[model samples]
Target: MRVVVGTCGFQRGRRIHYRLLDAVEVQQTFYDPPPKSQLESWRREAPENFEFTVKAWMLVTHGYNLRLWRRLKREVVGDRSAYGGFKLTRENLWAWSVTLESASALKARIIVVQTPATFRASEDNSERVVEFFNNVERGGFTIAWEPRGTWWNNRDLLEETARKAGLIIAGDVLRERLPPRGQEIVYARLHGLGGAEVNYRYKYTDSDLEMLASIICGGGWREAYVMFNNIHSFDDALRFKQRLGGWCGS
Candidate 1:
């Protein structure tokens, strides 16, 4: 199996991070996608073998009420209702286009679309999810969905939708098990563990890394991408790579 380990974002200087890991899931793409020119510059700077995974812009996943919307570079005008929750509207599609362009510029193969927990598993939301996935132009990029909250209550529907849409479910392996079929790669994110659904203050222990290694190795996927999202992501990811015997020399 080919296991790729890295942090959600650069934990150190670019050159230093490149030497420590082989992959990275760019978090900036989520809040505000950078210009293609900037992304291209980053791609050119990284080693040819380095892999980048872009996160879909917030306009594509979060609602107007989401606090992160304040961080958007471009202000949303009137009628913000049609903006998020996978509305399949022109605005959301445009956001996806920008996200795709950013990924293309970075030569990234994976784009993670992470929905907020507030996006429930209701009928309207479900339809929006189906429509959004069915109509979007993938541009030969692997789109991974990270559905949170009540979406997991209906496991069958979740797997069915992903299967029909050819989506890989990017999940926190500690909290949920990814679908066993319909995906060639295993995309796992480590978001820390504590009182809340996603806690960033925690640090992973050696035992946690051991269990994580077992989960990915036993998943039966030919390739796996493991991204650490906690505050200690840099150190934890390095530990994970060592555990998997893929250490890149610290």
Candidate 2:
């Protein structure tokens, strides 16, 4: 099994982290898709064995949250309010296209589509989910879905959707203990503990790291990715690597 342990985003500089970590789930692409040259430059700079997973832009999932729309004003390529939830709107389709191009440039093996807690598992949303995945050309990469909110409460729907679409049900392993929905790829994000669905400020304990390592190593996945999204991601990721008998970077 090939196991990759890293952070949601580099805690230190990319140059430093690139040497110390072999994987990273790019977060910036979700807010704005960077230029192809920049993405390819990143992929080129990294070691050949490195794993780069990109997150789908918010325009693919979240609705018209004016707050973020205003925040991403300069970054917004076009109308920011055009996509959200499970609506396969024109804007959302454009966002997916751009996201795929970025992933191709980065030579990413996985792409994450994370939905906010507000995105419930209603019939409309579920059907939209089916349409979106069925229609989108995922290309050579694996599509991982991190559905937040009540979707977590409905494992059957999540599993059915993933099985049908060939998606991995990526989730916070700390909160919900779910086996890899797909044998192809196992993906997990550590978003800290004890604060809503995500506690970004929390640091993991040694015991927590031990338990995490055990779960990840025990999971029968062909490939596994563990990413730390908490503030203590740097330290925790390093420690987890050590526990997993993993080395730093290539």
The weakest ten consecutive residues by lDDT in model 2 span 241-250
TM-scores for all candidates: the values are 0.93, 0.92
lDDT of 2 at 24: 92
Task: Give the per-residue lDDT digits (tens) of candidate 2, residues 17-119.
Answer: 6777779999888876778899999999888888899999888888677676664632445565667765667777777888899999999989999988788
- Candidate 1: Cα lDDT at 95: 81
Query: Which numbered prediction scores highest in lDDT against the true structure?
Result: 1
Superposed Cα deviation of residue 21, candidate 1 (Å): 0.5
Residue 167 of candidate 2: its Cα lDDT? Answer: 78
Give candidate 2 regions above 4 Å deviation: 73-81, 180-182, 246-250
Q: Model 1 over residues 34-57: C-alpha lDDT tens digits?
A: 778888999999999999999998
| lDDT against the true structure, each candidate | 0.83, 0.80
